[model samples]
Target chain A: MSKRSDPRLIERVLRGEHAAASRALSLVIDEAPEADALSKAFFPKSGSAQKIGVCGPPGAGKSSLTSRLVAHYRKQKLKIGILAVDPSSPISGGAFLGDRLRIQEHAMDPGVFIRSLANRGMIGGVSYTIFGAMHVLEAWGCDKIIVETVGTGQDEVEIGKVADTIVYVTTPSMGDEIQAMKAGVMEIGDIFVVNKSDLHGSDKALSDLRSAMSLGRTHEAKPWEPPVLGTSALTGKGVDELGKALDDHWTHLKKSEEGRRRLREQHKEELSLYISRRVYRSALDKISDRNLDDLVEHKIDPASLGTKILKK
Target chain B: MESKPFRVLIAKPGLDGHDRGAKVIVRALRDAGFEVIYTGIRQTPEMIAQTALQEDVDAVGLSLLSGAHMTLFPQITKLLKDRGLKDVLVFGGGIIPDEDVAKLKKKGIDQVFGPGTPLTTIVDYLNSRLPSVKKK
Candidate 1:
């Protein structure tokens, strides 16, 4: 009932309490401080789960692809967690949060956990609260985690940096073949998948992808070649093969030091940026003179001043 | 004095654009006296972590309806741990099943509210879980 009494609920959650975990998640979502403590209590035990990032352009059938992958993974009896990030309404700066409607198959599957996040105006494709949720899910013993980004622009490329394996979904109709050739989205893909393959020109799209892959070829002893797979996510065709390919990639990662090194780098970069932001925000909050005193006085340019402050 | 309400970021990570439940929860959280930051949608784990750290939010809530929870949630958790923002609460609500709730709990998810879960329950949970309020 009171914030002070929230610890018991959290305690219950930490001790494998189910109902309390649900309650605590809601509290955290509501931004309650008690939820903060609960998160702290749980943080130490988190981060063992493997995270996979999924991204692509809008209308790429990302939801359908993700849902099929869920079914595929479920067949392996692995505990799965999905984080679907949706686009926010530009006018209200709020998200419709519509991914739930698309993937209704997992609604009753106790082995699956699906959470949606709104972009909330972050420049890159992700939600502010996603990391916390990921950590919580990992600590809960999920073997695999999949993060889906809002499909749009080059921002989704950010998923490549966070996910162990980035699955870039495309459709034959969306001109993804041409889009892939344009550079930004081209290089970030670890695996290229063409969904809605039942449509005409699907083979052409696959060939285009292959040609694109060949064009970017370099001599760096590649561990695994990014493969192009075709699938009709609606009909479940080629879903099994796609799943197998993903599994193969996971296996390759387990055997190589390159994967571990990249993960460490990701962690390092993430931490540094996080700290810088924190320090900058603290300075902003403590500054009492909100008006542009320095800018108006012409003492320093806004861009230069921003860099100077952030450097500290 | 009117205190600066708790800043809460409610985000949808990944490319699943079904966010009706997230919107509903966001409204409920806002009504409960929190300054809610609703990130429009489609976010990477890195973006979400970065936003939380930058915003200095008291809590970060994720809504996932796509089945990418296993991959997405763990990355966010690890990012927070690595960033030393282990104190920020991270929880989620969506189409998660009952069995998965137990698994997520083990992953440090303080809570997991599924479909049909009441808003009042979320409100009460927040009231009970939040730490002592500080006037900004």
Candidate 2:
């Protein structure tokens, strides 16, 4: 836990050495003491790579679409990094990460670097180490970084805070139109994709998504309108369009005031995230078994105990 | 000091279709509190090593039932080493002959578990060997 990151290793990582990058990623994943140094060396080198988040329900072909997107980007000679998140079992604290199985074609490609992550009890579809991982990838010179979140439900909109763009995937007959009209995660999508378009009723799903977007309240004074695109990852259809849409968003973000605002927001979010992590760690460490028992037994009230712990 | 969960990669490295045994091991390893990345079936040595490098797993578990263990297991280990992963523990399971198991150990495979080996034995072996959990 007190490992020191070699400056030579950090240099190798900046030189685009995959092995060194992977090792740095391990340090970040473990939250080892050395990771703070790695982050300090890598943070300025980040923001060059486009961070894209892919989220959807289970069985929605999120992995397959991510694979296609990688292929699409690779065709243009872009270096790609992927972080695929899967849920950890509450009972065993273990996870079966299978997202790489769908994207195995790129396993041998030197231009592609993929890492699997367990949620580690963090909610909102991603692990807490994700930001640090992104820093490593960006420092390693990846032009595009794709973060595939754990299969998300209606409430896991945390991807919006982490990525520059969010692609929300859905399948045909997944839900009623009213479900699309609802608020939470539905409102955070920069691009809404109805994947598995090869299936029947895909047109209906597309129209429903389009109508829902139009009927919902708009982002006042926003320059870019979110597009609802249909894609079939099996046949690789409409994937080209999705790529173009993503590129357009990237360009818009560069040239628009809204984009600059988002970048500022992301930095703010990063600072707050670090503060909250330290606060929680120290606050939780302060709690004792007796204090917990008193709270459970209703002896010490919630407000007073919270104030006492925070004050300490 | 805080330690992360040990990550293990479970892969089938040949044209083997018998995967019930492999799935059982995967489940057992998961239950024993190790994060396992399972590449469904029919993987090449390059794929397995590449995956191990990207995932930064502490150990690699190769399961083969096609009797090609002799040809594939060593190649997988060599590829892992070629990728600068010399410290990763490589283990195999299948119908490997006793003599071949000895040869594999020399070629850098740490251990070989045959059919009918108890799940706890595999789990305990890994827990003891993984660098993530240093033996105290």
Candidate 3:
């Protein structure tokens, strides 16, 4: 650590200093003592970035879709941030975090930043650590941030609450579209993309999504129907359309009061969740060993005991 | 005597999702007696920093296979400097080219471990760079 606290680093990062940004992210992820104070200092300048979450079942090519979307976004001269969450190994409580190698093509781009989060047995599917990461990206001036979930479970649905736009990706052959629909994936998507569209039954998959959308009574909103686009991410087909759809959504959002309201609501939800997690962690940390023994001996139900202790 | 274990945060930056190398490094770091926080693939500079801050770690090690190291590393370094965390050593390993490694080091990256670099190299580097603490 340097003897002097250098605010220049933050300024440099804001000025697009990639090195500075990398360093700052390291500090944040590592949770060094000073990192919190630094982030607090930079908090006022954060939240300018747009957050987008992409989620779907495992093996649905979520990572591939994210890589392609990032490439498309970069072409538009926008700075992008990516977060790929992977499940932790249950036995070891470790994670491979291997998604980074799949998109090595963008390894050198200054306009793109990506991070992989280990689930760490976080029951909600998304890792507890990811929320902090999202805030850091916003502070770094990324125009858009994409968060990819580990699995397409209910936990993945939580992402819809964090992102400004939620894109649900499904491949044609994996029967994921059906599973997604059954899992209520259709309800959360702002945009549905059928990647690997060159495969057999691509049209059928598209029709399935279309029929799924039609099965619902209303189109959700005027001029805001969730559009399904076929994409062969391998060949870069339909990527442009996907990008345009994202732009269109952003434009629509800007034009509508509901969009702003939704954003505000999302922000409130995020803040509440953040605070709740902190409070829960703090309260749990305060639990005494004697209390644990009592609970283990069935002297008290954990929930009621916790409520009683919290009341104090 | 009980001693604090060195805590290290291993993060992946950029859209590259191939984390085989990062995962290997995380295990190596843990086996070497450090408490490792492995942030899985596709991390941005901002996310990495935030996790690092919250975890209160001693070192931040990034694993970037994507060529975005140039853009990602500098931002992380700057953020640390900006937030007054000059002591937390920031290093990484991946498909980074030798020339870029030099550039990153010059930009305050403590070290850059490229492909084919041994896990022992990383373990040794951490052991050397971090302050000595008693292992539990």
Best by TM-score: 2
Expressed as tens digits, the lDDT of each residue in B82-110 for candidate 3 is: 76566778898888888887889998888
Candidate 2's displacement at residue A20, Å, is: 0.9
- The C-alpha lDDT values of all candidates are 0.70, 0.89, 0.73
Of the candidates numbered 1 and 3, which has the greater lDDT value?
3
By summed lDDT, the worst window of 10 consecutive residues in model 3 chain A runs over A176-185
How do the residues B11-85 of candidate 2 rate in per-residue lDDT, one tens digit apiece? 999898888888898899888888999988989999999999888888999998898988999899989989978
lDDT tens readout by residue for model 2, A191-256 = 999999999999999998898888855668557789999999999999999999999999988888
> If scored against the real structure, what TM-score would every candidate get?
0.64, 0.94, 0.70
Candidate number 1, chain A TM-score: 0.84
Ranked candidates (TM-score, high to low): 2, 3, 1
Q: Candidate 1 — which residues are off by over 4 angstroms?
A: A1-5, A8-47, A89-91, A176-178, A218-221, A287-312, B1-136
Task: Return the top candidate by DockQ.
Answer: 2
Question: Mind giving the per-residue lDDT tens digits that candidate 3 earns over A117-204?
Answer: 6665665446664656676777777899888877665445777667778888888975634554565556888899988898899998
> Rank order by lDDT, top first?
2, 3, 1
